[model samples]
Target: MGRLLLVVRLARRDLRRRKAEALLLLLAILAATTTLTLGLVVRAAASDPYGTTRAVTHGPDVVAVADEPGDPIARAAGVVAASGPFPVAPAKLAAAGRESDVQVVGRDPAPTAVDQPAVTRGSWVRDGGVVVEAAFAADFGLHVGDPVTVGGRSLRVVGLAVSAAMAPYPGSSCWVKAGCASGVAPGTVLPPGLLRTPGLIWLTRADTVELAADPVYLIDLKLADPSAATAFATVHNGTAATPKPGRVAQGRPSLFLQPWPEIQADATRLARDSQILLLIGAWLLALLAVAGLSVLVGGRMADQTRRVGLLKAVGGTPGLVAAVLLAEYLVVAVVAAAAGLVIGSLTAPLLVDDTAGLIGAAHPAMTWATIGLVLAVALVVAVVATLVPALRAARVSTVRSLADAPRPPRRVGWLIAASARLPVPLLLALRLAGRRPRRVVLATASIAVTVSGIYVLLILNRFLNGNGPYDAAQVRVLRHVLLVWTVILLALAAVNAIVITWATVLDNRHSAALARALGATPGDVTTALTAAQVLPALAGAVLGIPVGFVLFAALMVITDGDGDRVPQPPPGQLAAVVLAVVVAVAGLTAVPARLARTTLP
Candidate 1:
């Protein structure tokens, strides 16, 4: 107990004495934890509004469309109640100076038992008036009492509502008998019967019957066991929600069914993509965090060697000393983790879609699963970063640590002869990387992550510009996620570069001073440090092309497995990215390299 308190006190004292160091440690882990938390929680947060909508509207378990009206769907087990067998018309809507494909459903004046759409604004369906799906209404800025023209027949907007029977606009599962097609729907196209960018709107039975378009019928089924929705849908259709790409319907088919789960998946697809982007960004940030923390630990260890010796001179046990060293970083990790959790939970809802397809997500509940995972990340980063350094510092002989001598330079005759012929800066640069290869590795890794991101961005931009699989709305969602990830990734990569350069500067100070004393200029020394970082960055940028290709390829497989529209970035553009990486690394390392020039032997 006494040793624990002593360890805590010492660690606390050290942290208080070095506020900047503590803050740097905090920021490193914070970047990782916050992003990871966002990745972990955003999906749940996005689903919150859907769950709320489902409960409020009494959403159905399964929805089926038939050629003939009046519950033509075959009888199935676990049936409790049903709604619909309502008339459906796939028509074009001109409303509020906007036009789009719409699925007009004929509903009764009163709400039904199942698949009840809760009106969010104004009255329900009435004669000569239509109730637009909340998401669809929000998309075109349509309001209650707005003028609308459906299939060239004029109508008045009466209400706006939400339902779980289908996803929001663009990806609505409400299909007509002949099906529909938009610019893009779920990447892979299975046309003819595939529903397009259709908005859901409700009209009175009389109004829908008067419509000029060919009509279809749909029935919403309620299962006794909601979990059996997938089973029901599969049984009804004899297939999953997503049929094979390029598949053709041979003949006049049976009923088309959409389970609520599949509908929900469509509804939350944007958020799912964002979640995936964030998780990947989080992983990249974690690698940067590890690289940064390692360099900082190495530098801090060098600075604190004398302190460790002093502690030993005062009769502190090695275990106590090591515990004290590790405690400081762990303390910051814990605090940073707590901060990250709160920030991430609060920020998650902000990333949800702006469309009113579902109710706005509330503040996410901080589940133990999320908390445990984040805390574990923080602790692991701290331990992995500091464990070896702490043990090495602890086990160092008291006299050796007290002397605090710089690391002895290795003698290599042939290498020296080769370097001797080169310019002073180039010579120093080569040896700098040779002596401390790990720093070069870390720098390379950091630059590789950033370059890989750039490479993917180029390809993705090409995909968006070309005949890509996503719609405009989906493209916008992806762009937003990409922007966020790019910003965070660049920030962390910059930090890693600075940390690695500064650590290298510290480690090479004595050698740099000796080089100056011998004949090399301060300019030479600074150039050497900058060149060391740039060389690794160049290699990293080259390596990043393949890495980025692999990562983007994996993402394509996940999003659109058989998509052939994926484009490779032009070689000229890739060369520019590599040059940019090297230039950026040199810039990041400049001040730190100059600092090395200022240090005394």
Candidate 2:
């Protein structure tokens, strides 16, 4: 207990003295944890609105449609209750100077036991007025008393409502004509057609009959065991070519069936896409965090060498010294993990669809599993970065550590000979880079990660802007995902550049002061420090271009397997990105290098 308390006090003092670096460490872990939490929770958050809508509307377990009109309930087994055999047909709807293709459903004025559309505004289906699906109404900015032209006839919007029969607006499950498919398919781009982005409207039976002479019939069923829907759909649709002795045969009347699980999955498709992207981005950020923290730990190790020696001289064991060094980061990691959990939970709902009609206000739930995962990641980052450095510091002899003099640079005969002919800044940068080759590699890798992320962003931006299958809303959602990823990547990369430059300055301060005494100007020392980082940034940017392409291709193959269809970014754009990254790195490192040089004794 005495040793533990002593370690805690020392760690606390160290953290307070290096407040900026401690904060940077905290932020690095926090960024990764926040992104990980979002990836884990987005899918569940998206389903909240649908679940609420389902409960409010008494949504069906399965919706079945047949061309030949008959009793839909009689054809299916295990149904506790059923509604519909309502008339459905595709038609054009024009309102507020905007025209859209819509599937109009004709229902009786009275409600049924199952699959009742919950009217959220105005009255239910009347003689000449129509009730629009709530999400659809909101998309088109329509309200009660607004005039709409449907199927060549004018009608006032009577009500707005929500139902669990299908997905929300622009994600309906039924199409107007053959070849216009329903439900979202992986990698399926929307072909130009009537059903690509459709709306839903409700009308009276008489009005629907007047609109379409031959309308399909729909039946909504509530099953005793909702989980049996897939089996029920197979049997009802007669999809099995070889039936059992008492089963229905293939080539029967065409029946379209949508199970509830499918409906819920469709509702969360946009969220799923965002989730996948964020999860990938979280991993990338984790890699950056590791690199950044490793460099930071190395810097801290140099700064704390004498402190370690002093403690050892005062009878502190190496184990106690190591504990003190590691404890500071562990405490910061814990705090960062907690902050990430709170922020991520509160921010997740904003990424989901939460229109008033689709769902009530979302209350994001934080599970113990999520907390455990986040903490595990944060601790892994801290341990991976700090362990080796702490151990090395602990193993140093007390007398040598207490000497507190800068270590001599290793001799590299060829490097010195080659650099002697170069300009002073370039010569100093090359010598400094060769001095700490491992740190240079890490700095290069950090820039590569950032540039690779930017490259992927460019590809995704182009894909979203192109004529691929997503609607405007989906495109917007995907763009939001890209924006989040870009912001985090750029911010962390900027932090890394400055940190690396500052660490270089600190490690070379003794040499720099000697150079000044030997007539090397402050300007030359600052330029050398900045140049060391800029050279690595340029190489990283160049290497990152191909890595980004490979990563984007792999992600596309995993998500859609349509790499051939994805257009490659132009060469000029990639070049521009590389140039921009180099410039940004130079700029980011400039202030830190200048400050370090100006403060030199």
Candidate 3:
């Protein structure tokens, strides 16, 4: 226990001394946790709302609504449910100078629907009383005692209550096309504009029976088999609620049945899509983690080696040393995970509300299952990233570590020898880079991954537009995004390239001096050094394009039935992609080469 305490203390001491690395790790985790929380919370809410609503409402297995009354299917359901044949229509409401379309169910004085809101204040009906949804009433500043008028009929607000049926489960408003201006009057109690898109309202069964209206427009069927929603859809296909063989109203298509599972499927897909984006965000955060930790681990290797030697002198076994090192990282990761969880809980609701709007659903309750899932993911990342450095620290040899110098070895490559005739600055830069191939490679790889992701994101944004390649708007957005991402990647890669060149020159100042003695010109040396960096830059860029495509394809979700006007990828663009990558690589190395040559005495 004492030994363990010492290990923990030492680890904490080391981390405290390296504040920069700790900050990077913290930022990465913070960003990742925020996105994960938002996505998961919204996803949970989208799939299912509060259980109370589910239990009390006992919603229909399938709701089939028609634009007009007179549908064999709706008539049948009304009779079976022992509910009234209700008259439902889309109406425009103009109250207090606020205009919004709404569904107006012309109900009979007698009611039959089981899910009706219990009236609180006014009479249920008297030819002058209208029962508005509690949410709508609140929004419009209406109360039971208030007087209002709809559809040319002056009415008193008689009731105020919550109704399960109207609770925006499949969101509050239905989607409306660009234009739907007709069939609405200035003072009419019309269906909310949203209702005209796709909605339901109910009238009294007596009204339908007296008007001899064939309340067959559509109906909600309550079924025994939740699992048989699809089967029931098939059983009833083309039978009743479906459009009569060739019936078309107002040149619009007739209504059809949509089963519960079908609605749930759409909801589930939307939720999953949002969550997938969060997963992507999480991975991106992991990459940032790698960058920060790699620097920390790399910087601390020398210290770690000396520590290993000291431990050995004290007779510490290899296993003990290894545990001590690894335990520190484990502790850091655990603490970060805890912090992430708290942050996620706070931010997840925003995501839920946004996604709920997309899927036509309400916010869901948070479950322990979801919390567990997110934490599990966070811990996995923590473990995977920290294990390697810990193991390497434990295995250091005492004698060699004690003898090791702080500076990495200086080595010369044939390319460096050939470029000796170059100017002094050029020679210095080339020789320095030649000595540390590993560091250069790591830097290049980092740049490549980031650039590839950006490129792929551009491609996806274009594909998502779904406009023909010729569509100016599609082309405009795509081009702008692509250009921005390309410029950003190029900028980062250029910095990395210059840094690598400078690092090489710094490392090889002595070799550079020797090359000058051997008759190398500064210009020759600069070109050769720049070539070394360029080789890796070129390789990385070449590999990035295809990787970008593969990543984008993996994230894409293909759906059918949206018009097919999108343009195909042009062959010219393919060539341009290759050319752009090559130019970027070459450009990355050019600036440093010029600087190396001009700055050398």
How well does each candidate superpose onto the true structure, as a TM-score?
0.91, 0.90, 0.61
Could you tell me how far off, in angstroms, the CA of residue 396 lies in candidate 3 after the best superposition?
2.8
- What candidate 2 gets wrong by more than 4 Å, as runs, is 71-75, 181-194, 230-253, 466-480, 516-519, 561-567
State the displacement of the C-alpha of residue 517, model 3, in Å, after optimal TM-score superposition: 12
Task: Itemize residue pairs with steric clashes in candidate 1.
Answer: none
Candidate 2 has a TM-score of 0.90
- Model 3 poorest ten-residue lDDT run: 240-249
lDDT tens digits, residues 1-601, model 2? 5988998899899999999899999999999999998888888888888888889889998887777569555445598888878888878899889987688898999998888888999989999999999878887889999999998899999999888887776566653433243323334555554343568899998999888887777888899999987777677765422111111122224677777877877677678778888888888888899889999999999888899999999998999989999999999999999998988888887776565447566567788999999999999999998998999999999998999778788778999999999988888888889898888999999999998888888887876776244556667777877788789989998988988988889888888888878878888889999999999999999999989988897787666546665678899999999999999999999999889866686
Summarize candidate 1's per-residue lDDT along 112-140 as a digit string, tens digits: 99888888899999888899998778767
Candidate 2, clashing residue pairs? Answer: 190-469
Candidate 3: tens digits of C-alpha lDDT, residues 1-601: 5887878887788678877655545545455555555556756665554233334445456555554555565444322442323455444555677655555555556544533334434556444456665445655566776766554545577765443333332223221211122212223343323232222222334332332233233355565555665666656554222211111213223455556655544434435444565665555555545543443444455457877778877888877777766665566666666676676666544444332112234454556776676566555555555556666766767786666544556666686677679756555545555566666665557555655666555554555553321123223433442443344334444444555555555444555556667787766676666666665655665666676565555665332211222233464664565566556655766676666554453
Report the Cα lDDT for residue 450, model 3: 56
Give me the overall lDDT of model 3: 0.51
* Model 1: residue 71 alpha-carbon error in angstroms: 4.7
| Strongest candidate by TM-score | 1
RMSD of each: 3.2, 5.0, 9.2
